[model samples]
Target chain A: MSEILLQIDGREVEARKGMTILEAAQSAGIFIPTLCHHEKLEAYGACRICTVEVEARGRKNLVAACVYPVEQNLVVRTRSEKIDRIRKMILELLLAHAPDAFALQDLAKEYGADKDRFEKEASFCIHCGLCVRYCAEVKKKNAVGFVDRGTRREISFIPEIASKECWNCKECFPLCPTEALQAAFVLTKALFSP
Target chain B: MPRINSATELEELRKGILSKRDPNKPCIAICAGTGCLALGNDRVISAFEEEVKKQTLEAKVDIRATGCHGFCEKGPNIIIYPEEICYIEVTPEDVPEIVSQTVLGKEVIDRLIYTDPNTGEKAAHQSEIPFYKNQMRHLIGNNSKIDPKSIDEYLALGGYSALSKSLFEMSPEQVLEEIKKANLRGRGGGGFPAGLKWETARNAPGEEKYVIVNGHEGEPGAFMDRALFTGNPHSVLEGLIIGAYAIGSHQGFIYTRHDSPQLRNNIAVALTQAEEYGLLGENILGSGFNFNVEVHLDIGIFVSGESSALMRSIEGKNPEPRPKYIRTSVSGIWEKPSNLNNVETWANVPQIINRGSEWYTSIGTERSKGTKLISLSGNIVNTGVVEVPFGTTLREIVYDIGGGIPNGKKLKAVHFGGPMGGSIPESLLDTPLDFDELAKLGAPIGAGGMFVLDEDTNMVDVTRFFLNFLTNESCGKCVPCREGIRQMLKIVTNISEGKGREGDIELLEEISEVAGAASLCALGKTASDPLLSTLRYFRDEYEANIKEKKCRA
Candidate 1:
């Protein structure tokens, strides 16, 4: 791979041409927050928490650090006023879904995000797709998957697959940012068990 | 009929078709478009057929059920040939008199012609009608001339000549160059240059490239794509085939909506007819350039209209849009170079090739070239598909062609692009229909869905209505769009219900910035456009609902 030279938060970093800004920052030990991204699996740019300011070829844009590929002489800002506001609003919005999600609460404290900035929906699932991708990509079980679309989208454990494989391999349980995954798995087990 | 083998044979076939048709034949062209069909043009069509047979004038007076005539408000519409006499709101009972007086006697019917409601002036001929007169009709003008299902009629109208010209006369590079010089921007939305996109797909390192026709006209008020595709399917197919040749693609896909059986049937028939005529498939017109096409139907969602999502749907996967940091032209549909354009954009390709770039550039404005097919709906007096050059002003479309607003209600705002687009207030009605011009006024001419709102229409309710639609249609892949729209909808709904707080507008703007900037795809990015544009022009209405608990509409 050709070596790519770029800057992250004003610090010089060396990355490969195919590397994403998140991967480059991680290699250089720079801090960036993420919710739906995992190193073992492909980048799912669902949660916009890692949205960073990027400038290349005299054009500046806000892109998810996980999916935006690194370029030669690219400038990336991990934190900015605009980015922080986006992250803060994201935290507040996600909080409405899962009010007690510990990961969100930690970010909420840091970003000064209100727990009830909007109406409380409390669906308990933020639709991170972590459990789904983990089951499908890492474990190769395909036990959990996304169901429906848009605001009603949620992760559901497939009863046919989960009942057979998820009994011993609770691998996706801890990956959930909230209790929704475990709750879903338990519900599926109870509903499908003979 | 045997398959045409060469340009000479194609020309011979065209001549053979033309020789059989007489220019002065008294053909009763009935409007059987979706609008007219809904208004019971099918009964009228059957009535005309029976009347012609009963009168034993079937051979002399030809009854052709053509496509949309554009004056939808007055449909079931018909235009008699030779004299070009126009009739509106035709019924089954009127079919007999139409056949006798108009077709047989060549006498114009006084009561059936278009009478302007505002001016009380009568227009007997189709050209005299203000709606048809104002339009340039470069694309949809043929709807009233030819029957959609008849390949012979299309050939008589100079259909596949563009394809023949491109294959026999011009090289692919020359074809691409002409399109580039013509500056034909995408009519679907975004107004991106079609030539540049084709060049990128052509240059992308790949042996297999694909082109797609986005027939998924999911915009609520937009039906022009359907009118053009269904009425003149061959025109769009011819354009798609020519585009495939120019882009050096062996395969192309037509992705249309699963609804509208007429549209799907017309496209299916068009494809089969083109293949049989050797205008498509292997060794098209015996030019040794092999290409084929397949028709795919969307699973029925607005998001499926997004280029990436449409490509994904074609791949038999869930139709979700990917971040287009890398253009789809470089990597799409199983990682092959793919060029996707809307149905209207593809339909314009054949015209650019048939007419030289200079002739094509003679019309429209500085950047935008050629005519745009706009579907006018809502409070307008005339709700139908209109085709006008790009430089035409909104006032011309609204006042002249649209016949102004109905019920003498004052015009409020004209919303373009459906749920994903913005609106322009009455003050900006003079803004040209050019892509950049309307975009500058915060209302992009997206797929050309012009919805007129009257004085009684509340802008806040309208914004909320569009948001509610998006909230259900959103694919929920990203946080900024799904959750952000949820919160924004909550605020807007509350504001519309007179429960908005003092800082709700600022909060909505802040969320719009984040959603607009941080979202992964175009759906999320443009989801807030309606709210932002309404807030831009009609802030006082929102303020009135919030501060005084009253609606200003």
Candidate 2:
């Protein structure tokens, strides 16, 4: 791939064409925080923690670094007051759902988010989509998926398919950011796997 | 019956249809729109038919079910031809009197006429009525003339002539130039210029581009698009074909409300009929340009109206809006350029082409050209869809067309737009309905739903209602919008319930700014608009809720 020159946090970086801002920042040795993003999978912009101000062609707005591909003459700011505030707010919300997830707690502490600003939601999944993606994309089981939508959206297991296809495959267990899926994987393995 | 091969054959068909219609024939046009249908207009229709047969006036008189006549407050309504006499709240029992007296005896029915509140005078004619007067009904007025089910009725009113003109006469480039010169902004909330979006999609790379007609009018109290789509769907379809021709898109989609089966069916029939006549699909009217359209229903959420999310929904994915860094107009729906416009914006296309761009530009304000369809609802004497020019003041709409606030109550404020919109206090009622002017006053003409609030209405409560609506409707994929709206809703609810803290408003503002700036899509970015605008204008109400623990009248 041909390399394109771009600026990240006032420093120059050469990134291959079709490389995302997050990837470019990583290659340039600049640290940028991310959630709902995995190197082995496609960019899932669900968590929105890697938001950065990107300016290109006289236009600028906040974009998810994971999904936004780097281009020639592109300028990106990885951190700012607006960026931090958004990240903090997102963490504050995330903590309400998966408050005990150690990575989320550390991220929250780094961003200095308030703990009780929002009410807690009832789920441990936190909607990272890592497990869902791993199960669907890598494992090729198609056993777990997101159902419903909006605030009520939750990751639901199709028991009929999971019972048939997921007994031996513990592949999605190690990929989850939270340990919510480990017990289910063990239960499926113990009950169904010969 | 065969596919029309040339514009000449299309015109000849239109001529044949028009020549067969008798102008002097006495016809009864009954509204079968959703609003009228709810009031059992179908029964009224059957009653009229039965009464007409009983009276032996079947051959001489024609009773046809038309679309919404716009004055939905006084339905089920009927407009008689040859004199344009309007009858309101028509019932099956009244059908005999209407047929015997109004149609046969050539006399007026005083009890059925709409009485003017101010003058204490009754109006029988459609044009003379205050609700229909003092306004420009360019797009919606056609609903009263044609049956939405019949293409013949639409043709008799000179419908596809605009398409014929655009396809046979003007080049695609010329059509784009006219739309650009007309400065027709999207009637969708953002008010972005329609021509600029079309030009972007037309010029964007990739041979396959898609044009979308957003019929998901899920905005609270906004049934204008639904009326337009359900009443005269062919107008919207004809407009879509013209837009596709201009944008060089062979494929199009009309995404409408999934709950409205009538709307879905009407559009389905329109598409089938249009295709049958060679108006759509494979070399439309022998112009060597081909276009085809499909109808898709929405996921039934308010946020699905966002362009990006709607595109995702059409792609058979969850209707969650992603950050539009690529700007959906250029790269949307399977990563191809897709040009999407609101139902009203597309409906205005035919009018712009039929009348020159100069003619279209002559109406409305300097910046926002063309007349807008405003759905007048909430605490008003007349709650229905009304079409008026852009520069018309809120005062005129509230007092004249809306028939003033109900039950002699003092005017409190007017809420424009829907959940993502703001309210205009009665003190600023003279604010014109122009896009820039209303936006300058902190109110945007979102979906053109003009909800009038009165003395008893609580401003804080109004804002709280909208926030709660958005909180539920949000896709929850993004953090700021999902949590920020939830937090704002909590604060607003606390303040409304008299348990608010001292720093609650400041906290709300901080969250608003973050959510408005950082959120992934338009739903997240503008999620705080209703709360912010209310705080800007009605700060005293919030303070009262916090300090005094009481609501202000």
What is the C-alpha lDDT profile of model 2 across A61-129, one tens digit per residue? 788899898999999999898899888988887777777777787888889987666777746667787
Q: For residues B122-182, write the lDDT of model 1, one tens digit per residue.
A: 9998788998899999889999998999888999989999999999999999999999999
Model 2 accuracy (lDDT, Cα): 0.87
Best by DockQ: 1
- What TM-score, computed on C-alpha atoms, does each candidate reach? 0.98, 0.96
Residue-by-residue lDDT tens digits, candidate 2, B203-248? 9999999999999888888999989988999899998999999999
The 10 consecutive residues of candidate 1 chain B with the worst lDDT sum are B58-67
Best by TM-score: 1
lDDT, residue B245, model 2: 92
Model 2 chain A worst lDDT run, 10 consecutive residues = A185-194
Q: Model 1 chain A, poorest ten-residue lDDT window? A: A182-191
Candidates' RMSD to native: 1.5, 2.3
